[model samples]
Target: MTTDAVDAPSGRSASFTVLTTGYTLSTGPGVAATVSYVTDGGRHVVVDPGMVAHRDRILGPLAELGLTADRVTDVVLSHHHPDNTLNVGLFGEATVHDHKAEYRADQWLDRDADGHALTPSLRLIATPGHSPEDITLLAGTPDGVVAFVGDLWWRPNGPVEDPVSPDQAVLRASRERVLAVADVIVPGHGAPFRAADALL
Candidate 1:
């Protein structure tokens, strides 16, 4: 996956820019780890670190932007999929907060890894349809709330697969949890959206 500078759509607040770390399976040409960074004072958060295949490429652009993994305060994973989490250990020093039920402590191991500390401000809303561990991170900001919804739904142009994992009920509940609070919906792959129509 290659990094690209996408122009923020009109009407969006100019304080932040959404940096796409290439496409992944869930997004087709649009699938990607949609990591967002606020250009100024807000906390530095990486929505999904993506797989090892695109790790260096993803971080390289951040370096050019004068940002490093160590500087990242939060690594929010939408789910427990390997593509979104395989490289999580790389950001050893940052607090790795995820869905409490989905989090596995052993996944944080590395030779020089700094243990992760979970934060309560960010709530892990259970959204399990795509996978049993799928959950969205509800991040509250002074402006509004941002929901990092992993594979809950793909990019509008991406393939539409049924989110049926035997845990469909849980997944539906998760979607509701996000719909209740998210002002901005940032999926695991593809672009971010502001309206409910954008989510479907």
Candidate 2:
């Protein structure tokens, strides 16, 4: 429900808004991945448009922001997990970005996510742990760098440990790397939080 913006050299501002704060039920089978909308000049990006309680949770917010799915120029997936990629086709007009490539229509472009700049203020960094294919989106805004991290911390208070991570040590390293630059973190299944408050 809030937007943050940062002015870029090209006189365009980069901005982002949490379209829907996602959630997961600890006691039952329920989960929704946090989805976000980001804009850098003419580029409109959607991050992790995955499973949600309802599609309105995603569309309604975009509509409120004066945008429609067709206007999204790009879609970034954090990993291949169903909870993080199930709704990707929702933005069919968008060129999809994942760990290793970009997909649009029938064209597939091979590229590494790490150090890749999607726009003047949005870049990707490799953060494999939750999944070997995991990547984090780094967005520059007035509030500082906000990282869209997939299940990196789950929540600010911490899952302390990620039970499903292929390598907990690697995950910890990834968390540290993000904390080094991100002032705020948009976790996969929770509202954003201050990076300093994140529990490893």
Candidate 3:
């Protein structure tokens, strides 16, 4: 809804802004999910492109900011779940990044530090649990480490325990790991939250 930019960490010339389409799905009253877009310099970098039907709602906000789908350089998926990855193919010009086990493959970053460097300031993290191949995008900007944790949790409400998840224990540990470092949290299915508030 807003075009808010964050200063790139370590004095990189290019700055980026992360805008979410708020809550897309209408599963129930108060049960809405989010699909996020990161404007890294100029190209649009999207994560967890929710439902295919909600494509316009997601892209519409980006268009308002002057970035378009054709400029999306990477469609980084957090997991194989349809709510998160099914619509990834919509970004025809972008490469989909995730572990091969769950969905499409190609740019796989196996380790935590091996993030897919979208720009000098932004990258992706392999955060599994919601699914074996789940990942999160980490943007090192002046605001702090902004984590786009798809399916890792449902924001202010907390973690999800779906029958599909391989290991909730690992998810718990990953959440702790992420919270310890992240300043801003953009959950898969809710509004953005502060990591500090979640820790408390």
lDDT of each residue in 81-153, candidate 2, tens digit only: 8988888888989999999999999999999988788876788888888889999988888667888998876
**Greater-lDDT candidate between 2 and 3:** 2
Q: What are the Cα lDDT values of the candidates?
A: 0.56, 0.84, 0.64
RMSD of each: 9.3, 5.0, 6.5
lDDT (tens digit, per residue) of candidate 3 on 9-122: 332333344444334334434333477776556546777776644567767777887777777777777776666666676687776666542222453434343344667767
In TM-score terms, candidate 1 sits at: 0.67
Model 1: lDDT equals: 0.56
Cα error, candidate 2, residue 150 (Å): 1.1
- TM for candidate 3 is 0.76
| Candidate number with the higher lDDT (1 or 3) | 3
Regions more than 4 Å wrong, model 2:
1-12, 27-29
Error of 1 at 59 (Å): 1.2
Candidate 2: global Cα-lDDT?
0.84
Q: Sort by TM-score, best first: what order?
A: 2, 3, 1
Q: Which TM-score value belongs to model 2? A: 0.91
Which segments of model 1 are wrong by more than 4 Å? 1-17, 21-32, 38-43, 101-121, 157-164, 198-200
